[model samples]
Target chain A: MKVRVTVMLKDGVLDPQGKAIGHALQTLGFDGVHDVRVGKVIELDLHGAGEEETHKKAEDMARNLLANLVIEDYSIEVVS
Target chain B: MKVRVTVMLKDGVLDPQGKAIGHALQTLGFDGVHDVRVGKVIELDLHGAGEEETHKKAEDMARNLLANLVIEDYSIEVVS
Candidate 1:
């Protein structure tokens, strides 16, 4: 199975990198561009794991290393 | 409308950060964890734009700001 995990900054978090990119876009003449928030996606390929086991593993991966839960939120999707 | 842009390291790209994260996961006792690749997602909220316009804007954003096309691949979705 394949798993996709998306980790994003929580609302109200200050995203300096996103802000910098937004500024760059405006400089490049992209009109009507507003706020830009950047997050992360982690794609995983698992072997010999059922959906239940894979979900648990993916959650553990997110909490342990993939995302900083204090400032980021994560969601996982399993593709069989 | 809102837009989601996902950017990922291309196949065969060396992702040192992802490797480090994978190593950390294994050290933390995550069994069966294999390769891990980290990517990015950018969310945008736009004002006064139709779906077609938003799609065009999103493509421009991906090309000019959100992604490094040389080493990364990106996809965009427009949410109305």
Candidate 2:
């Protein structure tokens, strides 16, 4: 199974990298852009018995290794 | 409109960050994981006339600023 984990800064947390990207975009004349948030996407290829087990393991991985519980939020999806 | 841009390293490119994450996961006892790849997801809030224009603008942003053409590829999506 393949799982995708998306880790993003939680709402209300400051994101300097996102701000920098937004500023650069505006400087480059992307006037329509109002806000920007940057995040990470981790794609995992797992060899597991079933989709349920894979999804559970992916979630555990996200909680334990992929995301910081304090400032980051993570979402996991089992991909085909 | 809101747009999402996912930028990832080219297939043949080496990703040390990804390798480190994979190794860390394995060390932490995620035995099911076989392979891993890391990428970026950028979310943008755009004020535009229509979906098509917003999508086009996002593509332009991805090409011009978000992705390194030589080693990275980007995909744009008009997110609700």
Candidate 3:
């Protein structure tokens, strides 16, 4: 099975990197670019796991390794 | 308009951070977790832009600020 995970900064958190990019975009003539929030996408390949088991495993992967729980939240989508 | 951009490491590139997470997931008892590749997602808010303009602007943003062209590639989706 394959899984895709997206991890994002929680709302209300300051994203310095995103902010910098927003500013840079304006400088580069991309008018009207207001705010940018940056997050992460993780793609995984798994073996020997069913759908339910894979979902659980993907969640565990997020909670334990892929995300910083204090500042980030993650969602998983299974493909194939 | 709103745009979502996802940036990912090019295939065959070494993703050290993702590899570390994959190892950690195994340690945390996530069976069948094999390979992991990490990427970035960016959400943007724009004003005074139409869909075609927004898509072009978003691409400029990606090329100028959001992605490292040497190691990463980005795609954009417009919503709202």
Q: Which structure among the candidates has the greatest DockQ? A: 2
lDDT of 1 by residue, A1-80 (tens): 78899999999999998888788888998878778888988888766799998998899888988889999999999977
Compare candidates 1 and 3 on TM-score and give the better one.
Answer: 1
Compose the digit string of candidate 2's lDDT tens values, residues A1-80. 88889999999999899999999999998897788999999989999548898889988999999999899999988896
Interface RMSD in angstroms for candidate 1: 1.3
Model 2, B1-80: lDDT tens per residue?
88889999999899898899889999998886788999999999998648998888988999899999999999898887
Better of 1 and 2 by DockQ: 2
lDDT tens digits, residue span A37-58, model 3: 9898999999998988888888
Q: Report iRMS values in order.
A: 1.3, 0.8, 1.2
Name the best candidate (by TM-score). 2
Worst 10 residues of 3 chain A by lDDT: A25-34
- Candidate 1 is graded, for docking, as medium
Off by over 4 Å in 2: none
The residue ranges of model 1 lying beyond 4 angstroms of the native Cα positions read none
Q: After superposition, how far is residue A74 of candidate 1 from its true place, in Å?
A: 0.8
**Global CA lDDT of candidate 2, please?**
0.90
Clashes per prediction?
0, 0, 0
Deviation from native of the Cα of residue B69 in model 3, angstroms: 2.8
**Candidate 3 clashes between residue pairs 3 or more apart in a chain or in different chains:** none
TM-scores of chain B, in order: 0.92, 0.94, 0.94
TM-score of chain A for the candidates in order shown: 0.91, 0.95, 0.94
